[model samples]
Target chain A: MSTPLISIRDLHVSFHTQDGVVKAVDGVSFDVMPGETLGIVGESGSGKSVTANAIMRLNFGTQVDVSGEIIMNGKNLLEVDDDELRTLRGRQMAMVFQDPLTALNPFYTVGNQIAEAYLIHHPKATKSEVREIVLNAMVKVGIPEPTKRMDSYPHEFSGGMRQRIVIAIALVNNPQLLIADEPTTALDVTVQAQILELIGTLQEEYGSAVMLITHDLGVIAETADRVMVMYAGHAVELANVDELFETPTHPYTVGLLGSVHSLDDSSRGALQTISGTPPSLINLPTGCAFHPRCRFELGENSLCRTEAPQLHAVGKSRSACHLPESQLLQIGAKGGV
Target chain B: MIYFVIRRLLFAVVLLFVVSFFTYVLFTALPTNPAALTCGKNCTPEVIARNEVRLGYDQPIHVQYGRFLKGIFAGRTYGPEGASVHCPAPALGYSFEYHECVTDLITRTFPVTLSVAIGAFVLWMGIGVGLGTLAALRRGRWQDRFATTFSVVGISLPTFFFALLAILVIVIWGGLLDFPQYTGFTENPIKWFSGLLLPWATLAILSASTYVRLTRNGILEVMNEEFVRLGLAKGVKRRTLIIKYVMRAAMVPIVTIAGLDFAALLGGAVITESVFNLPGMGKLSIRAVTDSDLPVLVATTLVAAVLIVVANAVVDILYGFLDPRVREKV
Candidate 1:
């Protein structure tokens, strides 16, 4: 529909390390629609952050080997030169890192830093105009006394406020695509709610697509429009947010949803956790990365080991397990921890 | 700030007094006799005893120290033991061996030491920091490799080795620049500069090498900081980011070490100064040692301690300014 705002195809990213090649993002494919909030769900080392960095092109010369088309506005982002990537990072796409405390220059006033973002794209802006725009951005993110706070250094702001300042810098440019990697993980729960709400409002007002990467399913449940579930660098499930929760197909997604504490059942049992650590990408399982942890333990787990399963649909949901069509509840009963 | 300065001054005074006492004890404990030095080398034993008695060397040690401390503030007149030892206002003590007022000697030497120190500090930092930034900008490239290799070579070589190598390259072998000889800055700044050119290069080579390693490491660390990456993610150009953000952020740690090195150099590098024969602080110290000029030696040590403390305080303030983390605590 109108050529997805951003499209990625068969993205493969491997990091060359001292001990062999580690496949970080293996055969990931996804798209984001204009003005939509697309939540990428995965635990640490699932390659979600790498995929986001691939879009911005700031992840350079890091022993990273990347392939596949990142078609955005009709050009593969992977092929853009460094200069164009520099321009693209702030003018078109921007990112917000997870650690709010360490995400702003300690020497600069918050106002100067935000204004720097705006001026980078429009370098000739008058000082007064830049000030106005920067303060407005702070205001939009709900910072009090925005004008005064602008001149204060990063340490002067509380953690929540610093996160807001980062958001201000990211949104000050009105970028076309925003990649926020766990932007609220550092804040208190209340502040996290406020920040998530602010980002949603900003996206709506600016009409820019958002690629929000986080492991917290609750965050996705509250904020995401459509969701992509990644496990071991592969998109195991993709569906509308409601469909994902209501009729999940991926075993990893099922484990994730069950792991999240729900309202009525919150008191009935201890919070569930997915069994086993996510596999090391350096020496991943022979076939379906999830097979070792999967159930329906077919004889020798043959299909899973010999042939990797491509994502297949079952009704309104998709899963990447080798099980043929079966009752979703039974499959989960077999796969669930 | 005023309170901090007052406390600092009080600390300096007490510290100087302690340092002076130690220097006095060490000087008195030496085998050489101050009484004989004050009288004459060939003076008879009877004459030396009379001179020692007259000079207050026979007085209790504490009383002698009290007199010496008082002399530093107001003034003093003492015989090199019943002879004539008249010193002016702001007198520290009289050196029997040097046959000169200790205060005058120190005051003259202080200016010479400071001139060399300030001049070389400016030059060394400029070259070191400039090279460091360029290397960081081209990280992983050949220039970065060159800087890395150079830093290894520069750091591995002893300070004395560099000083000698510089002398050979710039003075003796090259002959493009003359061997350094000290010229007072007040007399002729041009001559002072040229005369110290070889010394400057020598100091620069010794000092610049350390700065290059520190600065490269500092800048590289700053570049990897999360904020820097976030700064780029926010659309700031790389050049602006490097200039305004990374270097400024890196300078706090670098400046602290630089201030420490500055104070250390002020005391002197004996080998470097000796090789150059510049008659700077180190050479003065060596001369004082050989002559057993107790007052001058004590005064020099106290002067060095004061400079180091002041520099440390300045660095703390500068670090607070450059690093918000420091300012917030204060």
Candidate 2:
């Protein structure tokens, strides 16, 4: 296949503390294609934002020890210079944060902020041209009176409006990749839907790859083209969205499906919670990080505790679980229900 | 903007009037006679009453207050010593002790006082804010540790000690500096600055410690705000983001408290000026208080009161600018 938009190889991200070194992202690997909306689903503290920030080189000032190849566009992102990295961000890859309330500067007028962001990448655009684009983006994101509201500060805008402004800023440069870190988690459900719809429309218009990070399976189900399930700093499953949702091969994926299954579908019984909180990345288990939680274990599935599993194709999806072919079919069937 | 400014100015005028009236009431309500303090301790009760009649102290309190306020606003001609002394517009009063109008003394001396205050304000704020930003950026590093330690020592050491240390270092021990006392800047600018340098340095040492602590805390808090991380993700050049976004946002409360502190510093500069032997307003204020000179006392108090009001107004205007949450009534 042609090169994916992003390919991580043997990525190790660690932090040195007085207590010890914490391996936050341990030997993680994945690939995403251009124009694909890949959902990275994980609970809080699962190193989701860290992975995205690392790709954007936002981790420079932070004290993180990282080694591995983050290949994008045939270039090793790990080796990119500071100035080059800046040019890449917001122009090639923009990020939207979770808290819409604080996403914009309080002192600046919302219109000026959007205009300023647009100017950063496209410096030749005149004032009216920039304002035109800002208003269009704001209106497209469903904001009202774009002209009047543009002169207002961040506080004057509601939580939803502010999120829309943030969306406007992220799409101001028409970046090739958008990294949204739980962008809808802080807003009300109705507002979240509006923002999600905005993202969907903008993504189609711009045709940019989106790495949407959230533990909300509902969001991924509604928006992502493909989904990657992460556990303990590792991607446990990667597959096309429909294939993974209809038939998850990994036990962890099965557990996640059971927990997030909607009751409106009647086929799903009482929701099954995944039994425990996500394992801490600071001290992950020896073998498969999900081994202790997996119930479909057989002997030298003792090997499952001692040896880590790679992403091997079981059916239409790849899973990092050491289950037999028969058991994979059973897991997938159970997940489909 | 002008309407808001005018409103604030009106408030200031009312506030000054109330304060000057309160000063009059306080002196009248005193247990002893003002004429006794004005005349000699040897003067008997009859002589004191004679002096009181001559000085307008024998009049009703409101009339006495009217005369005082009139002296400050327009002018006054008081014949307390059997001769009329015409004090012109903006005159505070005739200082029987200084043998000149109190407003004239304050006017002649305000520049020196202002220079020392402004210099100290700039020194502490510049050094304090710079060190604070450095410390916050290098949070756990030696730079942070050093700043913390230095601030602790700076806050603990009294201004008198710092003034003496500088005097000892430059004047006595180092023998490299000699700042002659009481040369007004208008008379000789260079000598005036030299005379006041040690006092300004002394004033800055303590004031800067608090400012450093305040700014460090402010920057650290602003850094924690998710908006800062959002700016970073927006690819705002780190330097530009720090200056334009982070620092500007962090300056809100710091500016408010700093303005109030600057006003208070003029009041608190007594020790600093005394140690350096500078004859500025602080020293003048100390003498006025000791001698119970009503004219000088009331004049200095009024000046300090006006400074406070002006400073507060500036801070409030800045308040509307820094935090856009503060909506101006257009």
DockQ (Cα-based) for each candidate: 0.75, 0.64
B158-238, model 2: which lDDT tens digit per residue?
A: 888888888888888887668536577678888877776777778888888888798889999998787777777777887
lDDT of 2 by residue, A28-125 (tens): 78888888899999777677877887887776545689899999878898998877777777888888889989878888888988887888778899
TM-score per candidate = 0.92, 0.92
Q: What DockQ does candidate 1 have relative to the true complex? A: 0.75
Error of 1 at B122 (Å): 3.3
The window of 10 residues in a row where model 2 chain B has the poorest summed lDDT is B32-41
Cα displacement (Å) at residue B273, model 1: 1.7
Minimal lDDT window, size 10, model 1 chain A: A328-337
Write one digit per residue (lDDT tens) for candidate 1, span B158-224.
8777778887887788997777777887788888999877666667766777787788889989888
Candidate 1: tens digits of C-alpha lDDT, residues A1-337: 6669889999998889899898989998888888889999998999899899878766666688999989888888999876777778877888889999999988888988998899888889999999889989999999999877888999998999999999899988898899999999989999999999989999989998899999998899889999999998888888788888876777777778777777865454877677788899999988888877764435574887877778778656666777765755455544333
lDDT for B208 (candidate 1) = 79
